[model samples]
Target: MSGFASWIGGALGWTLGGPIGAAIGFAIGAAVDKATSKGLLLEPPKRGSQQRRKRVDPVYEKRRRRKTVREKQAQTKSGDFEVSLLVLSAIVMKVDGEVSESEKDFVRNYFTKMYGKQRANHAFKLFNGLLKKEDISTRQICQQIQMYMDHSSRLQLLHYLFGVTKADGHVDESEVDLIEKIAGYLYINDRDFQSIKAMFYNPVDSAYKILEIDKSATNNEIKKAYRKMAKKFHPDKLEHLGEEHMKGANEKFQKVQKAYEQLQKERGF
Candidate 1:
């Protein structure tokens, strides 16, 4: 009875526990055999148990995906703003054919006021760098501007460009031509453009009046009147309004140019 009990105890320990229990039983059997020449003890081995499976939390996975999407959106918006600012700056500088120091100063000052000093400086540097490329087309610049900037922002940028052209206190005919070309590229209509023109360039100036030529006016009087109107409606002096109002100025200036041109052609001057 005692031997059966010992055998059953050894089997239970080895099966329910692990290799350590089996080794301990074998050691005891070895010691007993050396003392009394008995056979070694044996027990059945236990089957290995499987490990517990890990669970994936759905909430954690969703949060990780959301974070990734937000990061991508931020990168896209940053790239777009940088490209838009660069193209707009280039168009403004090119409007007058030769970018004057006064124009550059005005751009710098305006941007510094609108954005911070550091951002303004960076934007100007980028614009200058882009302008150095000999093969770049104006259309390509406009396309980039269109891609990244909104409608209202583009209009505001156009206003700033006109402001730059007028920074020297005089708007040359070449400057007006350039502004018109840029406006066309921006898809601004003739009527709307004229509206902006009127806001900036007054058509009621004496030169326009001389173009109508009062019957009593002498040649000297006409010439003097032309000079006075030319100074006033030159497209550089009109101010104190937003770009939407400036559209009227543009229209007024176009009429002034046309009338002046017509008078010169008739007078053979």
Candidate 2:
């Protein structure tokens, strides 16, 4: 089968059951199909007789096609993820009653830096169009994301959302509330939510929140949580998500380390 067909089949296999999932999936599929059709996805027909084709290495051909299919699948998933980011970002930006141009530019620049000018422009246009609609639900978007993405990846996404809110130098209380709601809907545990929250928000409990532990927790427990969080946010762990994603993950991971150091200094560990 063609790469396009393979990607569509895989998308259909995902447990995207609700109206929100269906709408987002259809939009992403259409966008991916349009963007990829002129390139690697369109396979040319076999030009010769069966006997002539038999001379070719069957194993190599099979492996090559499989690799192509995997690439197409990854691309499709990445496209879908960016689209979802924009949708949820719109909601987050408007949580304080208005979406500022500065906030819009931050997202636009993010897309451009990550995806080239053409795709960025296309995505920004799609994002703007979607932003006009007033019916998007934070719960539905979170549910859809939670179904497909692993816990670590969701944490990384939350990190990026926090980054967006901080682009203006301070996060609005309303934005923080909406993000907490998104975290709940996405099934993210309270500890993980507060952990990521501390990375952006200034709080008296910064060290504990960063380690995802309470002040009453023993030193041993705090150390263990720090180690576990380090592994979870390591840049290597997010390599499959792409270079830009890895960069963002690394930034968060560094914050994790910084928090640990702060605790060590305070406790004289």
Candidate 3:
């Protein structure tokens, strides 16, 4: 149990149920077949009617394996973020008519940047299969995520989604509507939604939006907002999701910092 099987272990424990499981079943099966062929995962020989199933740590191998060097870290089923991303990416990419090459590249490049080429290839391959099924229910899939995923990871998911929506140069109105609805289903408040949304689509007051504050906010209010937003979007909040996910979390966190810095510079605070 290594490569793909290790990734599968997370789904087996968490997301391999309800709408999410139904949605990605084929893609996961296909990925398993490919991983098996690569000999990264060995199928144990069956004993009589009892099947031999190998059990691996639930996280994708990189994070779990790397964490072994550290002691007393919480480790358990972990692929919830990866699996959820695949389903949500398919939904976001396909929402605006056909999936654009730009959106595909955004996802592929992001995965490669975060997970390295080999694992990124595995993710994109599975994601392609998911894109084939265009009828995924966002509400149901989001419901599953909201119920099982931690709030910080959920925010990261929304951030990735907004990134996908903006990947094709311009964000479509339909995609915005759908993603907004998705935020609601994921239980994200409007302010948090706007904060993440502003990262991708910017206007004059975009920094204020990123801080979830209005233009008329007092200096003290702005300071509070900056501190609150900083805590909300901090990369450390997503540390449990592993180092790979920290890239996206850091992106959001930096936006919060930039927003704060802009306000600080403008008001001479």
Candidate 4:
């Protein structure tokens, strides 16, 4: 623990441990000294039957509430998308026996654009660290993602993995197998997996795959699928991920929109 953390633990009577502690410490900021002083200024509890619980400071309580809100906001701002991307990207790169230089360069540039050059290098180091591990569990990572991420987000995650595997213009069979296993762990439907897979590896019926619909589907069905996909891949949903991520989301959204337009034009609907 840093001096600030030590002082905070001692002063607030809080066991600084997890997310809550981090939030409170960040919220206290420069006001930590004042909060500590308030703690010190409290009257000591009397002995025996007269002993009472220490009075809670209203100001501190107010700050605590505010801290919770700030924590929620902070979580939203933190790059969940970016971190998840890196983790899965490592898996995609290493699935085929060895990580290729082209794949590494692709990931490095991707991270650099999302984060800065310094942070990108740090991310690459973390990627290398994961690769060094003897038993990296893809199932566990996918489980975590499936628990935290929405269905559409997971679909987008699969889409991104496909992008990484295809970065060198050829997707390895091992990479495809790994991605399919990841999709299974993520609880994604086979149809959904094939749908996203079609976009990158096979463009024969990409419009239907992009919209996640079928030729036998009615016009209303197509429209509904388009609306749902549009909402799912909307750039606005990625706004919390920063402008760079939003740009990527926008590109995905455009693909969905274009697919919808193509269907409409072809079907005269």
- Best candidate (score: TM-score): 3
TM-score to true structure, per model: 0.43, 0.73, 0.79, 0.68
RMSD of 3: 8.5
**Residue by residue across 206-247, what tens digits does model 2's lDDT show?**
988988888888878879989998998898776766786667
- On residues 1-269, what C-alpha lDDT tens digit does candidate 1 reach at each position? 23423432432311222332232333334332332233333433435647654686889978977676445333333223333444455555665466677777876776566455865665565456555543445564554344333443444445556666678787878777766776777666554455445445646544434344564666676677566545544444434222323453454456556665665676677
Question: For model 3, what is the alpha-carbon lDDT of residue 267?
Answer: 92
* lDDT to native, each model: 0.50, 0.71, 0.78, 0.68
> Where does candidate 3 have its weakest 10-residue lDDT segment?
69-78
The alpha-carbon lDDT assigned to residue 128 of candidate 2 equals 72
As for candidate 2, its clashing pairs are: none
Q: Which residue pairs collide in model 4, if any? A: none
Please give the TM-score that candidate 4 achieves against the real structure. 0.68
> How should the candidates be ordered by lDDT, best one leading?
3, 2, 4, 1
RMSD of each: 31.9, 9.8, 8.5, 10.8
Scanning candidate 1 in windows of ten residues, the lowest lDDT window is 13-22
Best by lDDT: 3
Query: Model 4, stretches more than 4 Å misplaced?
Result: 1-77
